[model samples]
Target: MTGIDETFAGRKGQASATPGAANVPPAATGARPSETRGVHPDAVAAIMAATHGDPFAVLGPHEVGPGVWEVRAVLPEAKSATLLTGGKRIPFERRHPEGFFVARVETQGRPLYELAVEDWDGSERTRHDPYGFGPSLEQHDIDALREVGSNVTYRILGAQAKAVDGIQGFRFAVWAPNARRVSVVGDFNAWDGRRHPMRLWQNGGVWELFIPGLKAGAHYKFELRGPDGSLLPLKADPVAFAAQKPPETASVLQGTSTPAWHDEKWMATRGEKDPRHVPISIYEVHLGSWARVAEEGNRYLTYKELADRLIPYVKEMGFTHIEMLPITEFPFDGSWGYQPVSLFAPTSRFGTPDDFAAFVDAAHEAGIGIMLDWVPGHFPLDAHGLGQFDGTHLYEHADPRQGFHQDWGTYIYNFGRTEVSTFLAANARFWLEHYHLDGLRVDAVASMLYLDYSRRQGEWIPNRYGGNENLDAIEFLRKTNEATYTHAPGTLTVAEESTSWPGVSHPTYTGGLGFGFKWNMGWMHDTLNFVSKETIHRRYHHHDLTFGLLYAFSENFVLPLSHDEVVHGKGSLLGKMPGDRWQKFANLRAYFGFMWGHPGKKLLFMGGEFGQEKEWNHNQSLDWHLLDDAHHRGVKDLVRDLNHLYLNVPALHARDTEAAGFQWLVADDQDNSVIAWARKGREAGEVAVVVSNFTPVVREGYRIGVPEAGFYREAINSDAERYGGSNVGNMGGVRAEAVPSHGQSHSITLTIPPLATTIFVRED
Candidate 1:
């Protein structure tokens, strides 16, 4: 074996760079363009010999001596030198072609020779080739690896059966190869694992312990000690079914997570699956305050109570889907369900896992789909739970460089670990299988896709030359999407990604992140900003509303007024309007109409459709009293009609059909702030033209284009006096021009109301 060695002459003479040293010519600079500097002939010969004429190859970096190292890795097509690490090879789905570098390594000593590799472009990075050397097998490195890898002896030895099945009165076992003593601590034993020292069975380096009298639903953790009398802290079972509060013990819930569908026969009644026509109106609600603890008490709204009270309310609202905030068990009450502790457990605050399943089933019976908010990118820093799970690094990396996240103040899972991956991927499948939920809305996905997502330099590790391609996280996300789709092909998974991470909603096979739809955060921000501006300002940025339409075709999109926009001083959607209360209501109605009119799926927060005046407070009930007001009543009516129009309009729901069948018949932002558009469909008389005016002045004869040349009638108007606005809408029908112009469009001069939206349809 070759050992790294340095001589006094070599180190003291050529290695030391003089403080004022300038460029000095060597014997031969012929390898100029490639090396950029003179390299020793022997060094060149050694590299070429090591890689066998593969001039592009470089030995990847490895720990050689104290603060020294040699780099060895084949940079087949890299643009620069790459960091390398020890990790299992996994197939990755590629979205855009980019070079992937392994993690950086910090070594002890200087190496005898240094190797550098470079490539012109990212064309050479592929799974079919190797780019770097395996991890160094130095003693310290091996010890570190063994420390992390050995912590989960139960993973390989199969004591995880206890975590899956639970251990009281049941056979529970785990193997800790490095531990001399093992104890099972869990809810079954009142969390006292020491009273019952687990029987230690050793087979080679594998150490096993089996405990009896544990039952499913029993929360469990392990207590281990090495031969050196070093005690390992309590550790959660890797495959727990249930988990203890916030940061401690994992729960081993009884029975399978799968539930038998009570409406199996009902599911077969659907003729053809059309997402557009499937009554897909989603009512986004927060469970904590949908109903409160007064009648339900601090005891909380059980899944049964929500089914009893909420199903009718949702069905009455004409919503066909219910999108819940993150229901996973979270510790902080103030968080709008973002800080999740347990990946598998539905928030116990809402009820048990089975209860959540019943709620989903109840909704299914009521002809509604349920979508859960899933947060997997970051986890809370809970010492009792996932953090330091096995005394040593188990689920996460030991090195602070690999484990911590500064932005979230939480520990991100080492997605590169196979078991960690399986845990996450299985959680995604578990929700779908157990609850029969139709979809999931993945939260904070931008954090999961990038290494430098929210990190500042010196706080985070970098690739060799200090680039920020988070290869592991990217691979994890890819695998997660693929596995989720594989498990349930039609199940919808939406991404709440803010960054322009390409193909987040693309299929997994194509190297995309594989989500069904991405929340149109861009549209939400731009539209909110534009609408909040004065009428004149809207004209200048009218294109802001239309900008998303360009790349919107690449992925399915959902325009959402999510919880983020409602809380923390952002204010409610109605509160964001630029005019009076009436104008505010009208503007909101117009915006919703426009949102539905745009080519995307739509979601309204719990209080949005009804015009709740107050911002969303997670702890309290929505201002249901607002519905009693005459002003808010019109908003509710408009929302109901919007849902009806969405259901009726074929142009709205045709798969992947967005603004293509639409045209801006009129957009004179100055003319009383009126704008109009039409949606065309094959059904001859099914077209609808929408006209809106922001000014209080009613126009007696505002000419707007119609798709057909015939008698046009007002279908719905937001300004009816009984509902709310100034009651300035035209009471009678307006006849269209005899001949059509501008692509079969007919202009009609009719009375239009200010601060109101009107839909005029052709009379058949």
Candidate 2:
């Protein structure tokens, strides 16, 4: 056996002269030439300072001579260390006082050994050496990472649990090209940076390490030194699958276990249908405040609880889909998930990742589609987030004009960068694929399309073509849409873009940003303004209701009375009506009838359906108790009936995006405050006629044109007494006469209810 006495013979005199050797006590015996010749003292100094860029070269087993091999380790907590190989124990020499040990052995090939360590408190443990393994990533991973739209960042980075050569552990990796050094620090290593300095792949600027014996649920963070050799704040993993509940910012190790999906039937047929031609009535919800268990300290419901309570309620309300507010992990509750930190993690505020998956499964099983409000536009500048990641503006632009959002006080993603754009595009695909989500409503897309968005003249930078459009962001969006549709066939992407940039919902091959649908902000603004006016003065603003039809088919649109419209002193939808309590409810019911009759898909914020009296407060539950009121319950029933009608009637939804589906029958009746139109289905002679009276006066003998001479049955009347309105109607049916009116060969005369919208379907 070659003991420490023979290995340290020549190193005694030389230790006093080496750079960091004075701090290391001399070994017991003189060192042999084979044991001490290969290792350098300067490398030891760098390792002792925890600033080594290439720890793999100096710390792992290295061949010293023809048959001799030397091994080195930096075990900070160990009082003594030994290398166990080939059924023999070789004790290591104490090269430094900071627990740096070295051992030389005679091995035929490379050495495979386990470390036996004794701590200062007299406790002993046996563990696999972290440096014993080779690199966990390959050249293909680096090549894929640098390619535009490759979307391999998540698979390559973050703490991934796996087995390396029959030993179970985690392989931690991060992208920090500008970092001089990066270390994986966690509770396993006593939060010490010196314990696990990672090996950098220079080609991709990724640092990786295989830490044997780490289990799932272990908290970890990347400790990085900037290019200038300055230590940066420990940053949470950008691609973390799960993170610690906020106020504490470490990333948790989530194993490679996927939830067993039971949504195959939903997934199999979703891609076969076209979203534009289907009846889509969305109930927008902020899960945190949707409902709280007041008895349980008013806490937010878990994902499982929401699956049980929320899904049944939505199904009962007759909504086809539920579009949730952002549920990605975010730091500030007030941001309502707009400013996300971990793009891949479902917010821990609800439950684990698997629990969230179960909620989606429940939604699918109930025949309800689920969509997430995805926010990739901007991220908050929290210290532990992606801001200033890697000690530089690696994920964001260095220039404030291109990087900072003045209105939101957040950091805009550097979409121009290949890695950053790929990161975002992959995240978009991740949610759709991993969670089996039906759709993603991309938030704040207008902020991403234009460089000068909400900025003063000199506060923004122009594109390469000297235009205000953000070219890089535009390309990123197009590629992301392409990837999402290609990978997750049934899923769709909707843009909450408030701009008139043409063909936002068009295919990318036609020089348009490819989104499945675009939110019609103009229609929302115009129609809401028209309904909020007093009954007598509504005639002056009559065009507000009619003007939207001029460009209704410009893009596939979603007529949204979203959360944005009900918050920030904007008041509830009920509060926006200018009238007494009874009139307010009447006007809101009429507006809902009109909206359901209009030429687009639908989305209504949660409280708007029940006419919540107060404005939305993100801190508390929605005024669910308001349903106790007769008028509020009536409004809720109206919404449920409207949804059912929209779903069952082909004429109302079959050709929503086509101009041939709608025709104006009495559009220019501003003097009487009345408007009328007809909706057609794909098949011939299938039609539904809708008329609205803005004034509070019942108009008898209201004549409207029809396509064919038949009996038209009153399908829905907003002024029915059951809906809290004066009982006024055409006695259930109106027969068309052979008289020409408004260019149609047939006409029908009926009583138009006061402050109501009445819908008629051809019965014969």
Candidate 3:
């Protein structure tokens, strides 16, 4: 006697002998000597070792003889076991020293029963055998899992809490094609692998089990044995809907209850309007460090708190949308959600999934959209994650050159694999459909588009065409975009691609990548470089400001001053200016005006609006106290006015993606370091003139061409005294004269303020 038999005695008719065996005859005990004769030896051995691929075939109820029914169970912690069925209790005979129990009944058919067992410590309980339930997934689910573009995988797989045969419990499923055995282990079963082995669906390589007594909120993980019978680490579910707070790596079961959504008006009309033709000014945020409760040990605010506080702030600031960094479950805090491990689970550091949904709903109710910075690029190789899942390179590439990211020290997904690609494509649909998110700004797209990205020669692998392009990744991206657009109509999908890949924001039917918007990385880099120089030196770099227009309308663009520009020792946007304290503030205000007046959408990271003097720190709150200074406060006010003007004026947004929307009136004025441009709307007589003086000397009576002759009101002036600038400008408005200049029939002579950008709209 080794395990359960070591404490409890065995009967005479039982197969295994123990310390206290009752010497009763077969007739007296109503038992036969051949009760365990028909059981297979190999099946018993496999069940004892927890390596049985199909535990249901041998562990559940079965017929051992013509009229004899047998119920078998592996209760390793039990001292005694009894089978209760049809209002009768039959004591089980110990079949092995390792706690294998079997009970034989002379019934006509296999009987349904429950196991009433006493643990080694004298605690007694009864449980419905997990193996008694049949497969919970249908044939259609298997087909969908195997299909290439199916977006229903999240609904089919993972721990789904449902009732099967009227028994309320959870049905667990995971894809591990090469695993020798897989089991559902949790606190309910004492984390025992042999207690609940899953049934294997060979069609999709998915292992499923229906635990009859399980409930939601229970933590669990899959215990797997590789194909070679070697036990691997406990792996977290890739499709887990929720997970334990970081540092404790267990997947929490969130039942099938969906959060109540009350954003009917936002959802109903979202798809009717095109984003390119609307005013879209986004406020990028990193939720964790944006604000914290300093009194309570500097803890991150809950999602509800954010909804209560952050939403109102964004609405007041006149931003149309709030773009948050990745909220997916991850292990490291410093990685900032970029190296995510659980793609499906929203990080538990915030409240539950339902709490996050409420936050989005709150934003929508406030007339603001929510966008997530989605990362489908690379994943960290953390133990208990997707790395070496099933003891093989199942989700990632096997070769280091193709599968590994040397720069990030992470594993790259093998987009060539059908299952892997399908998994990622379905994940994109999951967030958009399940959470009612307004948009997804795909991150690190440049890394996905190139095979030799950040790699030197001879250190990388080429595509099948012997080129640097990743063909499979390109196809996967195309498929993902197509699926999202088809399923979640009206939702935006923006790409953070930095290279010159043609037509990145164009239609897929025209051989484009099919992103709704692409970040204007070239404009950000060039404009930042030019503005960082002294005003006297700006003449040589004037092309940097004018060059972006050559391809501005090539794709729909969003001018982003994202968090990447401020962190990693790169200094703050205000600190990047080369001048005195007053001049630095003026330059930032001027650049913001320039960015807002340009021919694209706008996005500004948090703290940039108020001109935070210090660099962004993910571990601490933003320097919000800087707003106490009048200079910083003025910048914030300027941003608010810029957003409102951009929203109210159609000429600034209506034709943003069309070349006809913009015309340069002073593109070659490098010597004066002054440039002017005219913006036009779709309709006639809707036009605005913009002028910028990069130097510190105000130009008196500077002439700017205009398409229409009328009263041009100064809609916004970065040099206004209210924005901490020298109070110099055209008093109220400028009247266009008949003087022809810069190929236009009308022109306006105005006083251009120093280190400022001013906009004048024609009053129709």
Candidate 4:
């Protein structure tokens, strides 16, 4: 006789010889085995067709029972197995409710393959086939699908339209084929997404539970285990209506039936101002660092406290807008909100969802527009959410080419899927619709639109001719832009794309990416380099500063000194200057004036307004004490003044919308500097002359053209002592004398100060 293992393992111990056979009679043998018996050969053929024979080869048709059979296979070799199976394999591609079957096969403790069983009727393939955010499956892959287990389960119930009182309850269901029992435990049940032990319904295939008290704002997740007490993947519920943070378990949220809103009057009363005319003088602030707990006090700032303390200051400074960094729920404490796990849930770390809504409402009431920094390119690999969700393919794809992002060490969403697109689209709408935000500034767009982005040669695939354009991603972006604009006509959407993609800011109907504006990264880079250099050196680099104009028309732009440039290894803008404190102030002042004068909207980080001396650190508060320094205080005043002018000047506000608003009066890169023009509201002969002498020495007799023969007055000067300037040349009353032009127009003669930008207005 064979060894015990050998005797029972081959073909379900079919005896390899019928017991009666030679031992008794042909009558004892079952009627000729049914042709429909054992594994269906067509099913095996389908598996071969899908994977191209990548994982395993079918070995048998041996019958083990009346309806069951033992099918064997030569598993795909171990190293090659990972490519087809392992953690990255297609999951839930095949699942059924009749028999509740999912099959996954393993070799030597490592998943070598999987196969799913189909039902007698055709309902199995039609109903359980994976799509969108659901998992993918392979043939004969039951055991493996049973291995990873379920992250969340939901039941759909049709409630009679009349049954809804003040609160409505939902029927919840979970599918855990491997679990012996399950429970709903969450905040409603006091930290139990797995309590009120769901009743095992309909042949024990599904565990179902219902809570009469569930409603929006409730947080939750589920806990499940096997008969022998082995724990399965107890993950955060995927469809959780809402969620909270650490030390507290997630609860099932009841979606809001009626969101409290008082903004209809506000929306109706506001006029339809052109977005280009909207004066976007953004003040960027980090909520955590803007204020903090004293060593002797609490460690957090309530949303209300921040609104009372900060909103008034911003409104008083004349800022038209406020842009906040990411507020998504994240696990890491010190990050700049780059790491995000939950797509639908807000960070419980800040304040409750209602509190966040109130903060935005308060800002709107104060007439300050709000822009949120949205990070959708990638997500943190936190196990509690997104990662390995629902036993497979939740937020990512099975193939690394479609799944992993090399640069961020995070999972990129499979934008190609309908459910994934819906998830993100809903998220965008959630903020705009539910929270009443004015706009969104999408973060890290470069990563989202490129396939080869941050990948090594062997790691990524290119088009047939070897190019980097991610066609699917591009299509997805096109759809996203169209849907967003269609949903909210007036809300702004800005892309932080660093690459040279064309038409990023154009309208979608025009075959463009359809963002309302792009960050103007090229301008930011060139301007920073030019201003930080010595004025003399700037003369040689003047062309670099103006190079941005070639592509400036591709989209609207915003010149931003955002958190990315200041917080990382890159030094603070103030620290980059090669001069003393006074010279440093001069450089910064000139830069700000130049930035303001440029044909784009403006943004300054919180501390930059008051001249923060230290680099940004998320763990510590902004250097608030630095405001005491005279130089620092001067910069603050300058920013406020700039804001005042930005709001009041037609020349500035008008620039926001029309290309004709800005005109260059000079382009002399040889002289190390140049001058430009800005006009307002088609007013004839009404213009603003912006002149900068990047040279170290003052240019005494520099002459530029004017529209008319009137004298010009200095509207704002970077050399003013009150604004951290050296007070050089006292431009307070310097008038540019008008000289007759060779043509019908006229000209002006003025002394342009070194390291200063002067905005001249024609005296009426």
Q: Cα RMSD to native, each candidate?
A: 19.7, 5.4, 6.6, 14.5
The lDDT values for all models are 0.60, 0.86, 0.86, 0.59
Off by over 4 Å in 1: 1-182, 195-219, 224-239, 243-252, 257-260, 266-279, 295-299, 397-402, 462-467, 655-659, 667-672, 681-686, 709-713, 732-735, 741-743, 761-763
lDDT tens digits by residue: candidate 3, 597-646: 99999999999999989999988898888888989999999999999999
**TM-score of every candidate:** 0.72, 0.94, 0.94, 0.73
Where in model 2 is the C-alpha error above 4 Å? Answer: 1-35
lDDT of 1 by residue, 1-764 (tens): 11211211132321221111111112222233321222334333333222111111112233333443333332324565432223322222211123223222334443222223344754433221111211111222212222321222223322333331232233334434444455556664455433333432222222233333334566666666544546666755444445554433465544343554675643454324645334367889899887676654544577889999888888776776899998877768777677776665677676666777788888888877788999877676655456655455556666666677676677777877755665566677767755667788998888776667776776677755576766676666677677666655556788999988888887777878878788889989987887888765666776666567677666778888888889889898899988767678878877776776666788888888888888888878878777779878778887887777767666555533455556767654553566777766646665667776655678787777677777777776777765576777667567888555445556788787766677776676
The TM-score obtained by model 1 is 0.72
Backbone clash tally (model 3): 0
> Which pairs of residues have clashing backbones in candidate 3?
none
lDDT of 2 by residue, 165-212 (tens): 999999988888877778899888888888898877666677888999
Clashes of each: 30, 6, 0, 35
Per-residue lDDT of model 4, residues 144-259, tens digit only: 21211111111121111111223335444443433444555555545432223443322223444444434555555666545444444555654444456643535336443334
Model 2 gets an lDDT of 0.86
